[model samples]
Target chain A: MNPSAQHQDAEGARLGMWLFLFSELLMFGGLFVVFAVYLQRYPAQFADAGRQLSLFFGTGNTVLLLTSSLTVALAFEALRQNRQRLCQGLLGFTILAAGLFLVNKGLEWHAKFQHDLYPGSQTLRQAPAGQELFFGLYYLTTGLHGLHVIFGGVILSWVLVQVRQGRIIATRPTMLENGALYWHLVDVIWIFIFPLYYLLL
Target chain B: MGKVIQMGEYFRRGFLEPSGKQPALFDWIFSTDHKRIGLLYLYSICTFFAVGATIGLLIRLELIAPGRTIVGPQIYNALFTLHGVIMIFLFIIPGVPAAFGNFLLPLQIGARDVAFPRLNLLSWWLYIFGAIMALSALFGGGGAPDTGWTFYLPFAGETTTNVSLAVFGVFVLGFSSILTGLNFITTIHRMRAPGMTWSRLPLFIWSLYATAWVQVLATPILAITLVLILSERVLGLGLFDAARGGDPLMYQHLFWIYSHPAVYIMVLPPMGVVSEIIPVFARRPIFGYWFVAASSIAIAAAGSLVWGHHMFVSGMSDTAVLVFSLLTFIVAIPSAVKVFNWVATLYGGSIRLDAPMLFALTFVLLFSIGGLTGLILGSAATNVHVHDTHFVVGHFHYTMFGGGGFAFFAALHYWFPKFFGRMYNNRRATWAWGTMVIGFNLLYFSMMVVGMHGMPRRYYDYLPQFTHLNQIATIGSWILALGMALMAVNLLIALRRGQHVGANPWEAATLEWTVASPPPPENFEELPQVSHGPYDLKRAGEA
Candidate 1:
């Protein structure tokens, strides 16, 4: 939303971001469809696989992502009120939350790998028919979501820099708003993902 | 290298208006101008088109006889696979939308540039890079993939032919497509000039709008699908491979879910192209404008639901097949509505069979044949009979090549005056159109005929019974190639030495024609205010 010498449309920028977020939702939506079909085919196996995942890490990452969404929205509001310091602090907090989410995910995957439960492992292949697919969908959905968190962090960090330089102040918050929108999408996908993968049991 | 010396600055200025600070080639590459970026896409897409077409000719020649005529089985397999990938991903999918749409969308909508101009340049770059990555799979690592463009599962998972990189290339291409859709949607929503209401918009923009939605909503599914392919290879996930206990049918479901709508993304813009040209050459207000406009969106929506038709023979449930077959039949209505409308528009008017008109009319004929044959293939019984046969191959070629490909050629002829401010030799263009159509119909129609007679597709060798049709199709490919060469040469000559034209050479009533033949750097000297219907014969200039 920075006021360029040329005309700018903050509203148009927001629309573009929302459209992009729709793509992200559908991308994950595809995996959800795959997961749903497999769940129907091997419901008991999928539920058993669900119970195998560490609930503590899943819950922790879920909470972390939900809270990160809040901080980003607040950051957008603070940018609007010209509280540059609070905006930067809140944005930084959002990225830190993303980092923590990835850490929790890494720990969960590491625990699985230690037990030979990851995709393509002999143990996973030897397990029940549907369980390997469950783990496959599990890693694919969460891993892609992790990539999003990383991307969200990078986008927010850029916005933070722009805010720090006074380029993204109250009168020009399009960049921050778009970044926040992206972060919120990452959170929303995790919300669907956590329920399907961790809570279905 | 692209420098074609122009007589006036207006024509050159539109494309050469250095939007970036860089010099020469870099300037063009880095340009954020919609016009320049469109030309960038035009050049790159054409080069890819030539490569793909030549490969196609070779494939046809190899299939001319029962046994291998040129390449070995492996290389022949590679040739057709690359041809399909190149033609589908690199050429036809981006055909009209990337090149002409970029150049014309802003011009028609009365905008200086797309809503996200810098992002427009990024889409073209992504396109080029994705194309390179996809092509590199042929020369680098293992060898050219014979997995086909669909990259069907289990086999794609098992194949050692650099399938991952090729799939990854398409994933990147999907991003480019999604971004372009986002930009076009935003620009249409927020950048239309005052009084340029939705109904007043040209049908081409409407087609692009519908196309953008399909691109945004459907392509991401493909992105994920391709990512799964990479996952299967790199991370050894093997979600769709049977040996790993993964369901193979799921791969078909996911791929077609995106790809069926992808058919719309490929053909819809050309439907838009035909819509624009019909009224222009017919010199008549389009019959049933609202119906034509609504049908573009209708085709897009209905097209999405019919992905299951592709799965009918994959052992899906009878109820599922019934529903999908019904939806496939239903989707044809909208397209039929469009074809009827085009014919009606031409019925009571002074029609000019210019080069563009000739191609557009042929598109109507070819697309009609294609769409009707699609009904035969869509019927569960008939479709199962011809599932992976040459009939299926012929069906798609008719729809994609004859329908979309011809419309792209029509758009090229239609817009050449506006794009270059010059005219090609019309006589040569007609001869080219004739040869291409004759060749195109002969090539594809025989495939459909032999396909019905039970010749399987993608077979390197054919039985003696299918030899005559195969030979005919081979000859057709030669003629098609000759016509393509003639058209390319004719247009290239016009780029430099042709006679110049005025603002409205064909007297089109769209906003684009109201500007200088080659539009200014900023499309309009003053932003246009629309006060009349786009096709009003009485209205020449803006209010």
Candidate 2:
């Protein structure tokens, strides 16, 4: 029984992640302030430009991330029950959900790029003035979230390696709990992003 | 043999008797003990103060005749920038907290140490690293940062100076400040001994608690903002560039978001000092203790939102300016409440006019001037008139120097006996204080008058109408310098010649006074359960 096999440290690790998540929230809060002011100043242009986001892809990514969060939670539960094989299966499902999200995001970005709506591109040079802001925010939010997904994947892989080593067991599932907490935050942020970017229109 | 004799006598006179069980130089550098780290901070900050004061002397000398007598404009710009950078970042930011707060907070609160002692040591080392990097800009391609300490972009980005390194230095410094604040917050939350409830905690801890919040919440914004500026300088990120469709006003927003709360970071610890000092001198429990304590948190919270006030003339929206102006005025209410509480504490009480008390009394007056001028700035109309003028300079000196700096001196004087286990001559201390009081007013007050007469600030030379007042300020600077020199002399002499002090020389009621003058490596023999407020001098006397 490895010391890391117990879930006793889960609460501390989870709380630490939540605190880090709050700081991330505030970091993004600055950009939101800028966007809010700009939106207030150019409401119609913002709405017109926001309407261009592909709701189908946005909704698809949202569902992908939300489902991944459930699988990650179930993985933690499986670890609690000492069901290592099921736990790995659920994490594999969670990683698959992340893969689907990345594919959807790539296609959406490509579509926007084909339409020449990317920032500083000649396509956006002649587009509606507010469209540049739309693209600016679109790229920033999606790029940052994409970075988070990469970070989350790396974290999950570490958890997976720990699982492979028999390190994450019922009594020491803290690492798994912290991973689920982080994945849930990523899902929660996307929940806001989907409606704010794609559904606001 | 001679050195051995001196060391032996030093030990016998209570050096190694009890509190002098501290180790050699190796123990100092490698020690993670909070008290040792605190002493390290005190020595380093005082060195920075001296360096910054030297820069100040150069500026005053240059302003003596107002025609580049001491240096050229380029040199002058660099001088003032160095003064501001060293003083604000190195001196004032860490002034009371790292110096007195570090030394006192845990002992006063009956805690073993800060929650993270290793982090405390790291914060100090990081501060040293940041200081070295900042000073390194002097040897870079351009000599030091000339963008003022604010480092507003466009000027900061394109200002052909060594701003990139300086700003990077500041960014790193911001990290150190954040870590220190974080460490203090965790300590206050988790490290208090049993029965040290929030109400029972000393007001100094409350002030540190409030200051820590600003450090945690506001400093990262500064970190991000400085990083943005650094990227814009090095790699052309357009976060604040006006030409690349970025808003320059955003830089102001980001800078002040940390800086406005930084003012509280500067003032709160001294407010804590005044809280500690007034009760001991008045020989009574502090009146309106809750109000005084709450006002510190109130200032930290309200200070955060009013950063927009700094950008009133920076092309922010009318709505923002209006809102921020209102918020700025509202922010002053808490400071006034603290001031009123201090005065009320002095009322009908047997107030002892010790050197520390005299400085505290002077702080009350000087900070009033600073506060009243702040009201004028808070008004949208009056600010437009004095926004870039010497009046703002005067207001700042009055606030920072008269308010924070003077209170810091008071704390130094108040705690000198406790720190060094010795006492200085009262007569010389009085003389130093008198000259300083007059000299400080002469220097800053003349700046106000010249500022009101439509003279812009930060100029190497002014029009002749301002010449007389500038000359007066120069003269006053000399006087102030003389007084400060006297203070330094008195402290040195006290260290060598003054009478040895008892632990409770001022008859103070705080826990730090209950033990040796400089307590043992472990602060207390046994952690006492605090049963009374820190200012319970009456109870102390009865005991």
The estimated TM-scores of all candidates read: 0.97, 0.84
lDDT of 2 by residue, A13-91 (tens): 4544554565556555665666676677567767887888898898888888988999999999999998999999999
| lDDT for each residue of candidate 1 in B416-448, tens digit (9 for 90 to 100) | 998888899999999999999888988998999
Full-model lDDT, candidate 1: 0.89
Error of 1 at A145 (Å): 0.8
Which ranges of candidate 1 are over 4 A from the true structure? A1-6, B1-14, B17-22, B541-543
> Clashing pairs in model 1?
A1-A174
Candidate with maximal DockQ: 1
State residue A183's C-alpha deviation in candidate 1, in Å.
Answer: 1.0
DockQ of 1: 0.60
CA lDDT of A189 in candidate 1?
Answer: 88
DockQ of each: 0.60, 0.13
How far residue B308's Cα lies from its native spot in candidate 1, in Å, is 1.4
Where is the poorest 10-residue window by lDDT in model 2 chain B? Answer: B11-20
lDDT of each: 0.89, 0.80
Docking class of 2: incorrect
Model 2 pairs whose backbones collide? A5-A172, A6-A171, A6-A172, A6-A173, A7-A171, A7-A172, A7-A173
Model 2 alpha-carbon drift over 4 Å, by segment? A1-21, A42-201, B1-26, B242-244, B317-319, B424-427, B492-500, B541-543
